[model samples]
Target: MSPFNNHLEVAGFEKILLLKFSICVLFSVGVWVIYTQKARLSSIPNSKKALFFLLSFIILRILPFLIIYVILDFSARSDVRMFYDSALGALKLGFVYRDFETAYSPIFPYLTALPLLIWDSAKAIVLEMVLVEGIILWFTYKYYKNSLGNYYLLLYLMLPAPFVFSILGGQEDIWMWAFVLWTCFILRKNSNWLLAGLIMGLGLLTTKALLVLYLPALFIFAKKPWQFMLGLLIVGIPSLAFMYYHSELLFLSPIQQANDPRTPNIWSVLHPLTNGFVPIGPKILNWVGLVSIQALGIFFAIKSKKTSKPHYFLVFLFLIISVWLMIIQQSSLSNYAYVFLMPMVFFFGEQTNKKWLILLLLLNLFVVIQPPIWWGIGMPIFHSLSDLNSGYKVLEYITEIGVVVLLFAFLRIIIKNFKTTNNSNV
Candidate 1:
């Protein structure tokens, strides 16, 4: 029988199950979350309300795991054989066993396994993540006062995709949120590039390893460019050194997942759209397309009307696409759907109070309308591709391509800003 069928010898699955049952019985956080807002709303004062509300929220936040736990206990047992393979690989390599990751480091696997040893059944991981992600959101609101409003933290915690990912997929991507936001805060707000790059490097563990996602914004927003660059190097150089040391991995951390020969990427999209295909022999074409996407995004950033803002948005879009591409490239688009949610939040957030936040929000509300996931322009194409069994690769192509266009459009806005700056100087 496979490890999944047996639940590995890591701390006895039965013991873990007993422990979780005990915890659930002792603490009704999940149940409290289910009825939180309504229960607490009319009773609390304004000052303590948000904080009380947050506690109730964490319950719902952590509820998915409990539900999954029930299913896992009842027979919907997950084939964690894959997880075991990854962990043992780490052990065998004496470098932390990481399965399913060929091009990247073992940090993420360790994160998953570490939590399981203590809490059992991925619940421990999500619990830690909710707390961390919640703190980071609070930090964002406190500092970026103008950029955020009251209840934003609540909203971030409660977003449907985030809710599902945390409870269902048992993802730790939220921790990455802290690192990414830290990079942004330090480099853009505090002029600490070295720290920024380091945090950004650390952030790679959350999803894909993309160091420069927030750098362009630093360049645009930094009042002191020299200090900013110095800070960037401090944080970024260490990871770059590691990548080089593991040069065996070929510095492919960012796009390692995309190198899968099976899936269609942006370049693959070209084959379908152009009615011509590039032979998949050497990897030169993939590199070319990847570089082209970054270059295109950067070019738009330089050309936009609001230089700093566009730089941040473009960088954010690139990071989002890079992660989406990594997953879809392998034809595994399950549970990681939340990757699109953050980018959507930012894109729409940018236009808030500009002209059509109300209109856009209303339209987006319709997307969750009935039965199907209506991602607007994506619904028909995604459906057709699914019917053909090419859904995974095609979705990858569409999402990344859409990100590229949105990135470029935002870049155009930056170009206009630069021109205005130049003219003012003249």
Candidate 2:
């Protein structure tokens, strides 16, 4: 059975089943290898094991998906195509925002276009992403060697959210997370506020969602604010210059995006009450989300300033940003929230709550079963919600509700930690 679903029938269905089974086998064997090698996978000689784990993931996990992408050549998501185009456009003309239309920060075009200096194709974009992921994993292994075990590395790669989302979906959120993680590592390990702020400023230039982290991160750099501000200005000035030049196009994308109907977010719950004006509802919710996130960010930032465990504060800041990304953004997909996983592995280590991890993994499973939300298969089967049955509708609703619940859980943890800190002070 061909895995490419054209008619959505049993035609070539056997091939699809075989492919699925092969992927499962590969994953199981990969996990087995990690477990078998756990004894020797300690900190001193961790690189070889980390590299082995990365290769195994690429072969067992990513290779099959690469084959699938080849068979269904253009079935990949649009973000990569958009990135490729924006990058190419930036190279061909000028900057992406000044010339093309993208909501991404100004630096993304340059970053994406950097690859085009040697190669130019959607495949090249994915290849560049693979290299970026390899570099990120190497760094993660380096700073986090003491805490990160073979099992954590294996699971991080195999997890459906990070694996499929990064490889197949072609989302740049993974790259953003990698950058942010590296920044946090620098801040925590070296207490080098300047370098940390510089990396974070670059992160902000990659994705605006990083803004939610800036204030919270400030708490960690409070003693050396001047050096941090200097670092930010060094990398942030270029993007600011462009924004100053093209300030007119700045709000163009946001305005257009907000006018669309809400998706799996808090606004979606209020959308039904807004009549046909649901398209304009995010205009209000966007501001509300911003205020809410900032208020929480400031509170956590202050609380973090008083704590010795500053790294945990970074984790909470990441969680806050993830929640804002999940709920506040006018346009969001489930994969956007996986940025938390990078911090989760380092912070919780092997002692992390397995039940919650499993729950999050289960939520990501919904993406695999459901049709691609942002891809076009040249079939009319999944073009709209109307094309899907009431069952799919229910699934979508459940996914949204689950996100809200998760956001609330993180908020509760943040509040509890603050209260505990207050009592300890007294």
**Per-residue lDDT of candidate 2, residues 344-390 (tens digit):** 55444343354545554554454332224212222121223343344
lDDT of 1 by residue, 1-426 (tens): 432232122223334334433433333243234224433333455577457556746565545454656556422122233444444455454443112443334465555466556655434545555555556555655444332333334434544445544443344444545565565556445445555545555666444454344355445444455665665576457756764566555445446554544332334333445444434324675565456545544554455435444225433544444443432232223233344344334333433342332332222222112102212113222223233233323434554444333333434443343334322111
lDDT of 2: 0.57
Report the C-alpha displacement of residue 158, candidate 2, in angstroms: 0.6
Worst 10 residues of 2 by lDDT: 373-382
Q: By how many angstroms RMSD does model 2 differ from the true structure?
A: 6.0
How many backbone overlaps does candidate 2 show? 2
lDDT of 2 at 219: 44
The number of clashing residue pairs in each candidate reads: 23, 2
What TM-score does candidate 2 get on C-alpha atoms?
0.76
